[model samples]
Target: MEMLSGAEMVVRALQDEGVEYIFGYPGGAVLHIYDALFQQDTVNHILVRHEQAATHAADGYARSTGKPGVVLVTSGPGATNAITGIATAFMDSIPMVVLSGQVRSDWIGDDAFQETDMVGLSRPIVKHSFMVRDPRQIPEMIKKAFYIANTGRPGPVLVDIPKDHTAPHNTFPYEYPKKVKMRSYAPVTRGHSGQIRKAVDELLKAKRPVLYAGGGVVQGEASQALTALARKLNFPVTNTLMGLGAYPGSDEQFLGMLGMHGTYEANMAMHNADVILVAGARLDDRVTNDARKFCPGAKIIHIDIDPASISKNVAAHIPIVGPVKQVLEEMLTMLDEQGEVGTDTKSLERWWQEIAGWRKVHGLRYETNEQGPMKPQQVVQALYKATKGEAYVTSDVGQHQMFAAQHYLYDRPRQWINSGGLGTMGFGLPAAMGVQFAHPDAVVACVTGEGSIQMNIQELSTCLQYGLPIKIININNQALGMVRQWQDMQYGGRHSQSYMESLPDFVKLAESYGHVGMLVEKLEDLDGAMEEAFALKDRLVFMDIYVDPTEHVYPMHIADGSMRDMWLSKTERT
Candidate 1:
């Protein structure tokens, strides 16, 4: 065994974990750790302008690569600033390990400078929180952090390390744990055969069935199994916001997203389905709207790795707790042995006709003028066409996020990333940077709005410094579009502080950061601008596209409203 400082142990442990990049910002409390990190050559460090952006960048890296993203930050405000990012990752079930510095062990509870209760503050949002009391426990804690963060129902894990642990005199031999064993944390990876048989029996017996999938399927890497199951049964599939790319959006069986801003046909199908097969999706309020009235005619079958999520929100007739991929594989094998007891062909045709009627009546529609300011929908459509639906898309929370969700079609898991559970603003830019870092050869784009882009706009410097070719599409409406829409619909259009009185010129802002910037005001120039942005292979591009200020997202289901109570557009009421 070799002697090493606590800081050296931390760096060595990270190297053992195969950590390639660490997104973070340093401070006085973490100076020793930072120095250790500087001496390391295997791990690359990205210094983000804000601690929040650092977490987001790590989250993006995790989402895109299906690995536990690592973050390092100082104590006090640095740790606090990262809360939003941590909460966002937790809500979305993204795997992340956040390492924050703490005051010296001797100064504990003495109101030390930059000292805050990191464990208490983060307990609510993190899957688990730990404060390192002994320097020897650092290696073990690091191992546990990664294990917990990437295991069943993956989420962010926080570890607070005291400054004293990194003292020069403090020494411990470094050795990475060969395995992690948590007595109470073993996750069930296989579904019970009896329950799988029961679910398959129900699916074969039902005539009008729907598969509602969520991000859990993506997290489990079960898209292939999910696709096989859907195709074999010839069932229509609808995804939640987080589940967009679980099923190919171009497939005829795909019914688009199914929630508050879901497609008309998707919502209608859910309301009318006789059997609802839920795969890796939680029945959140946004999807259910009214729990009592949701899918009144359906018998629900929920499959998830976490047993607590089985029937917590909505009653599940058949609840199967296991990994999505394994469960789906088992179900498919059982169905094959049973000789494919498919649903009635005539009944399915009739159901399809009915769903087709709804699609024709309430399809996604938007108005645009070729000579006027570009519509947000038009810009998104243009981007989709320009990129050929191959770019990794991230979005900041607002109407622009909804528009991106609606217009862009994702055909694979991890292609589309957004703040679904937390709806955090300013998630786009940093997330895009993370995605770009994960897939340096692939195109990455961040679709943001005027209001949300300013939250972490300083990250543009990070992009420029790293030479990351991330495309930033700002839908400039000069207002908090989503809030304004709500105010217009629910608050008598008072507008409040939603409007941006002195919005900075995005093109000029991009130029200041030494990046290419383009402005598109007219609809006719959108395609050309998008083409130009896509052609730039080396430099970052910022496209500030002007859109209709008064425009609102359609097919909106307000709180406490049923799927049938959707508002089609501004001119149409429920």
Candidate 2:
């Protein structure tokens, strides 16, 4: 082992792990490490506009590439600002490693300048955290962090290195562990073979079956396996919002996204199915308004990597706790061995016919398209057409997110990235940047609402600095669309604190940031604007679309109601 300074060891350890990007910002506590990074060539550090954006960029990188996203931040506010991003990743189960610089070890408890208890502050959101007291612990701690972050039920991990540890006066022997094994934390990888057979038995016996999935299928890289199994059984599939791209959205068997603001057919199928084969999804409150009343007739077969997730909210008759990809692949193998399905095929045919009727009752069809302001639903479709359904699309939360999920048909995994659980606003721009960084030649777009986009609009400078040409689709409804819809439904139309007055001109704002900008107000101009924005391959284009302010997301779930019960349109609201 060669002697190296603590800062050098930090950089070297990252290089050893094959980390290509480090999303972070610089400060006094991390100066030495930044200096060491400046002297390196293999690992590139991306300077983000805010510490929160750094964590989100890393999240996007991890979600798209299947590698643990790395982050570096100073103490105090640097670490605290990243809590939302960390929580977002935690709630969604994205793999990430966050390296934070701390105050001197001797001054830690004395509350030195720029010092805060990062470990305690982030403990609730992170999968695990470490405080480095010795310079010798750097390499191994990093190894442990990555290992913990990317394993089963992937989430963010934090490593807090005291400034004293990285002092220039210190030197230590460094070696990254080839492989790490922690006796206390060995996650189960393979499901029980007997359980697989039991699940198969249940699957083959059902006539009306729905293959419901969530983010787990994508995070576990089981999308292909899931697709194969669903096609083999000819079962109708529905995805949660986070699970949008897990199944081919354009396929005939896909019933579209299910739950609140989901498609009519998908929600109906879940409510009416005789059996529900759930994969990689914990039926969250967003999907199941009243867990006690969710799919009472369906026998649930749940597959998850975490045992605790199974039946935590909804009862699972067949709970298989293992990695989703392995479990699905094993199930496919057993199907092959069984040779042929002996169940009544006529029942499935009738089931499909019923689903087809619900499909025709979809909420995506506009009420009136010929007059008045542009529709956000049409904007999402125009974006899909402009990119030929090939762009890496990311979005902030709200009406636009739901619209994107309902209209933009994703044919492959990792194409649709957004904050599903935490519903964090301002995730789109930085996430788009990270996605573009991962696939430089591929088209990238950020579908954002006016309220959500303003949360992190300053990232435009970072985009210019990095030469990332991402299309920004701004759906300007001149109001907090979702908030207004809810307030209107629940509070007798009290528009207090919901209407967004005096919105800035997004076109001028984009130009001020040194990027191309255009305003699309007419329905006829929507497609043309999207096509033009995408044609500017070397420049970032911001398309500010003025959609109908009165439009609200359809198929909204009723309170204390089943999945099939929904407000299909504004007229049906409460």
Looking at model 1, which ten-residue stretch has the lowest summed lDDT?
362-371
* Per-candidate TM-score against the hidden true structure: 0.98, 0.99
Model 1 C-alpha lDDT per residue in residues 381-447, reported as the tens digit of each score = 9999999998999999999999999999999999999999999999999999899999999999999
What RMSD does model 2 have?
Answer: 1.1
lDDT of 2 at 480: 90
Full-model lDDT for every candidate: 0.92, 0.91
Off by over 4 Å in 1: none
315-404, model 2: which lDDT tens digit per residue?
999999999999999999998887885554788899999999988886667775687888899899999999999889999999999999
The deviation in Å at residue 161 for candidate 2 is 0.8
Task: State the weakest 10-residue window (summed lDDT) of model 2.
Answer: 360-369
lDDT of 2 at 470: 94
Q: lDDT for model 2, on a 0 to 1 scale? A: 0.91
